[model samples]
Target: MISRVTQQTVQKSTLANLQLNLSRMSDLQGRLSGGKLITKPSDDPGGTASALQLRASQRAAEQVARNVDNGIGWLGTVDSALQTSLDSLRRARDLTVQGANGSMSAQARDAIAVEIEGIRSAMLSEANTSFLGRSVFAGTSNTGVAFAPDYTHQGAPGSSVERRISSDATVRVDVDGSAVYGQGPWDPVTATGSVFGLLDQIAADLRAGLPISDHIAHLDTRRDSMLGELGAVGSRYGRLETVQQGVQKTIMDLKGQVSAIEDIDLAETMVELQSQEVAYQAALGATARVLQPSLLDFLR
Candidate 1:
């Protein structure tokens, strides 16, 4: 069909083309300046969703990383305390053996008793070891110390401190103080299963000039308990170390994914921006030539 081509229609068409070109240039400039492919969600809906999901995951991983660091600190303190306690028990054993000797004089026995008292103090100190003011052996209890002066356990029976290493896994950072150090008098019925109770028994025997071969056996049993806990702590520490590596690697991978999805490729954007600028300028020149000048142009 034949149609009339009016001047106003031509002018409107030219203005629309110029506006479209200017909008394109503006978008490219925004991307270049912001250095992001998706400044607003409208830019790319699917990519924005993916980027948001990846960022949430990254934050979770970062929190797990913090938990790992705290867990390592707690476990390291526990392991070292257990080792030191074991050494103290060994020394106590040697002293017990010396005290059990038939030829040792009364004065010598008394002196050995004094030394055994010192070992007991040292072991108690180790049992109460802490990480950032919280007892490592306290099993989630906020009692501030694992064992009281009377050798009674202060930690909760089964409750423990734990740290999350991943979305699916958590590791216990605190140990069972009652199991490792003995509750009250250790074996309450015997009044002498706890390390402190046993040490007390040894000291009494030494002062009374009584044979203490049994004390040495008791020390061995307590030492074995310390060794078992130490082994367990070591295993957990190794696990945390491995998990930390995985978490760190996962965080790095998540960052790369997000960057790919959201970050602009500067080189590509620069080239596109230059092209858009050229197109916009050409559109402006073309529009100026096609449209007839108004009365304002005549007055000017």
Candidate 2:
């Protein structure tokens, strides 16, 4: 038996092949214009999933980088305040030694006391230092100032403000105010309890022309405490800088991963697009010649 081939069969097959070629051309054009290998999940399911995962990781890393920056800001403010406090204390020590001189008359002693009072006021200002409207040394306290006018510590002990810089890393941004400034008012039973109170005592003795040589020892002790805090602040600053560098590197790595998964290579895409275009044109010309009506076919 001989099978008869119909003209309708040839026409249907030709149209289907042409439609497939057109579809491929359209897809290549879209990829070229969009500059992405995977515009939709159907384009490349495995690549799409990988790109999505990489993007999520990138976003998370970027957020951690932001946390590192915020932590750095808080620590920087703390470092500056501690430095200013140390300088003020050193000046106070120099003035205290001058007032302790026995040759100084009552008039000169009174002047020294007044100057000490001024230094105390300045130190009080430093104690109450605020950064971005919040007290940096206040240990998460919502109080407007870290210390009150009378030098009472408003921040709680062992409390700290912190930020997460990575999955395994956290940084403390706030310091303990009581540790830096003490509990305020002096207790007669225990000497050198509060820096402010110690200064007050020194100033009072100077006003009465009393020997302040003994007070110099207390001043030196308080200076040592301030220096210790300055050291702690400096340590925190160095840690933040190190963490920042690590966070930046993590962000950049995540970005590169995302680009490799989701983004297209322009040169490769251009070459592929041109090849697809030529193939589609060839398909169209072949289909035209195959479907064209001949003199014998028209008579049939």
Candidate 3:
């Protein structure tokens, strides 16, 4: 059977082909202008899904980087406070040693006591140090000060503040003030005693002209504790730094991946756009010729 070709079929086919060519040209131009290979899901469903996933990963990595930066700042504040506390303790220890000397007169001991009192005040201030208006050594306590003026601990105990630096990694950013300063004045009676209590005892003994040998030993022990904390803070700070570096690298890598998935190559896009323009022009010419012949046949 011989099939008759109609003018209607030729006109419809020409219009459809021209529309497709125009659509392709529009898409290429959009890609070139937007600098994105996939502006819509219909453009490339698989590639759109991949780009969305990569964008989500990039956003998450950026958030992690921010968390790492905040953690670093918190740890830095802690490290600085601990260093100051250590210095105060060392100075107190030096005074205690000097006060232990029998050759020192009562007036001299009194002066040492005054200086020790000042050091105690300074240590208390350090213990109450705040970072971003929150106590750095107070765990999650919402109190403005970690330690009260009466040497009472106002912060919560045994709580940890942590920051997520990556998808699978978290790091602690706070230290326990009670561990460093004892349970404030409520601390149990011990050989070394609470940090504040030890300083008070040392000052009292110096003022009373009493033997400070045990007090000296306690001071040394407290100093050792402070040194240990300083070491721990330093270790945590170093870990944060390392984690920050890794997070930064991950962010960069994620950005690159997102770019690969979503961003267009300018040169390639320009070449494709030119090719589509040429094809669209040829389609327009072909459509005109096809439609003219169909119109003549329809007239006949």
Candidate 4:
């Protein structure tokens, strides 16, 4: 009876060791198959939390990048319009200068005035530029044309809009059209009126055969004002571009961070997985040998 009891005890111990080795092999298999140790919170609470945070940051960064893209598009429209405005103003100024010359007859000056009027009309049309159905120059108001039908600015003074590109980064989405188109330290129009208005007045003086040296002189001053406004618009364009670059950099950094948190290191993971596979194979071999023992072998 004592000998039989000893045999039973040995068998039970061998079975327990076999079960333990098999469990270890199963764990190794799991690790080899799944690159990450924490597929779920139950697998590793801290890793799960960290991954969640990283994913969240990545999503936020993507959305901000979209915002930056939209802002850049809007800025591009403004830049293009300002370029057109400058060109038109230059042409108008030339016409004014030509008309002011004494060698030209009144008929010639009047003919030139017609052309100036055309340029002025074109400038007015340009001022009403829109982006995605919203007025680029309409202060904060997006409902309609940037300028009134009479070519006056059509929104609240000093109203501006902004867009966020990152947690700490933001940029203004517009520069006032009135400011860019006329005179200012930043007035949208001159005391006399907008560029179109001044051009109309100049054209009228030339048509009436009135002495237009004074009109030309006023236009030259307004030309300087227009040039100043163009410079300011150019500066704003540069600033928006600078902010866009910053947002791009921030997006790149955030992408790297996200990759670090969520993406597997392929080289390292492959090495670890190979190691786990070898370990599991070794454990399987050991357990097979241990569990292969039979009653006949024991008797022998």
Candidate 5:
């Protein structure tokens, strides 16, 4: 049999080990309640690495969603400006038709010319549309205005803006400004020529007492061409809406994936925590009985 001193030492050692285990159990309880797998680097290196990667991916996806939102804003602005331009063009066309009746006096035509000049200035302002300090139609020059103050456009001929929606997917966020406003199918409006310019020229001829029906007919052709350009841009806006819907779906999918990776299964974690608490209580009861013997009992 061990001496009393030896037995006492054994109990002290057992109590020290039990205290250490209880401290560990308390730490686990806190972590389980908090619903996190690891609180420190020493607790779980691999899990921490995986969690960081998931967070990064989630952040990147959110930024792409923001990019899509900004693109939508820009498209809406362009669409609005185009709608205004179309209305002004139609109104100007109507005025020209009325003025060509030959019975209208020069003063009456001059009044119409004044209104057309206003529409010209309005169109020039629309061409310079902006969003968040950047010109929506400026091609690649983020720092430059889309249209010069004199109604001229500048940028890469067909530069495109793109956003990375996913690790493997990229989507065009903007239509090329040159494609929409400067050249190609709608090139009749010179980069330097304001829609106002044509209207002003017609107004000047009418005021100068020239017969203007043929000139009005030519202006009609340009008006129709501008309408066609508006239609194309409207189609592009519709396509962007479609792309935005797809992006929303992708964001939902990515959120689901990140939740799967980072969120603890609450039901499972609660069950394990309860079971561990019960086991710890049972261990405490057993340890109390074992550690409760007195030095007097050993002497007797």
Candidate 6:
């Protein structure tokens, strides 16, 4: 025997179909408004997870780029100070050469010594140069001055300031002042004579009419050390620039990946929305026609 269909079952089926069509339309409208496929994790769990991961990676790359910029600034400050110090040392060397000439009178030698002293003072100031309120050549020391008042190195030795430019890389942004200027107490016997001490001794020799050949050699050595440090600073600056470029590119790529995972296809979504609208209207019309007549009409 065949089972008889009831009007109540027919009405229930129509209501369920209508509800499903309305839900589909609502979801399409939401995607259109938001312009993204993954409005919530439930929309597309795998795609939402990928988007979150990419967003996190993008943020980290941006932070690393900022660190690279700060590193570049610190290295630039150090390079500028070293340049000024190098110039002052060269000037002091020129005066020393002139003072060493036997043809120069005592008064003339005294005048040269005075100028050399000024150069030495200026070099000391450069050594104590600071960037962002911290000594650039003082390693990790937060002291405002890299060198003490007595021409002694005041910055921490063997400690460097480093900035993380990438996941696997850290770059040193500071120089070791003690290595370039020698240690404090400026010992001549211990081979730790600073440029300041060397200039002071040269000034004394000029006044006493003593030979300054050894002093000239020491001056050259200090100048060489300064040059080496300057070169290292330039190298680090160049490396930071390269890292900055790489980070910028990584950020761009990560953003693209996130967009692909999270952003909606407007054209395709619009087409699907129009199709759903047509189907929903068709279902409503069919339900209206099918439910128009009832059991009362059949009894009449």
Which lDDT values do the candidates have, in the order given? 0.87, 0.81, 0.82, 0.70, 0.66, 0.87
Question: Please, what are the lDDT tens digits per residue for candidate 2 over residues 180-254?
Answer: 777677765577466888788888988877887877787788778778878877787788788779778877887
Better of 1 and 4 by lDDT: 1
lDDT of 5 by residue, 137-247 (tens): 676676556666544566565676665545676555444454444422222344233455566666776687666576566566656666675676677667666766876
Q: Work out the TM-score per prediction.
A: 0.90, 0.91, 0.87, 0.76, 0.77, 0.85
Candidate 6 residue 94 C-alpha distance from true site, Å: 1.6
lDDT per residue for candidate 4 within 1-300, as digits (tens), equals: 455556557656766766676675565456547644555678667767877887777677667767767887887887787788778887887787788787788789889889988998798788888888888888688657777656668756889867786578667777777765552222223435677777877788788876556555555665675566567656655766676687577668876765565456667666765676676567667656656778899799
* Per-residue lDDT of candidate 1, residues 1-300 (tens digit): 999987788889999999999898898888888888898999999999999999999999999999999999999999888888888888888888888997999999999999989988888888899999999998878899999888888998778998988778899998887777775654524645678878877888788878788667767777788888888999999999998999999999999999999889999999998998898899889888877578798799
Better of 5 and 6 by lDDT: 6
Worst 10 residues of 6 by lDDT: 183-192
Higher-TM-score candidate of 1 and 3: 1
Error of 1 at 27 (Å): 1.8
Q: Which rank order by TM-score, best down to worst?
A: 2, 1, 3, 6, 5, 4
Error of 1 at 213 (Å): 1.7
Q: How close is candidate 6 to the true structure, as a TM-score?
A: 0.85
Clashing residue pairs, backbone N/CA/C < 3 A, model 6: none
> In candidate 4, how many Å is residue 262 off?
3.7
Alpha carbon lDDT at 126, candidate 1? 88
| Model 5 RMSD, rounded to 1 decimal | 4.5
Better of 2 and 3 by TM-score: 2
Candidate 2 clash total?
0
**Candidate 5, residue 88: lDDT:** 76
Per-residue CA lDDT of model 3 for 131-193, tens digit only, reads 889998788999888877777777775688999876687888888887787754422255533
Count clashing pairs, candidate 4. 1
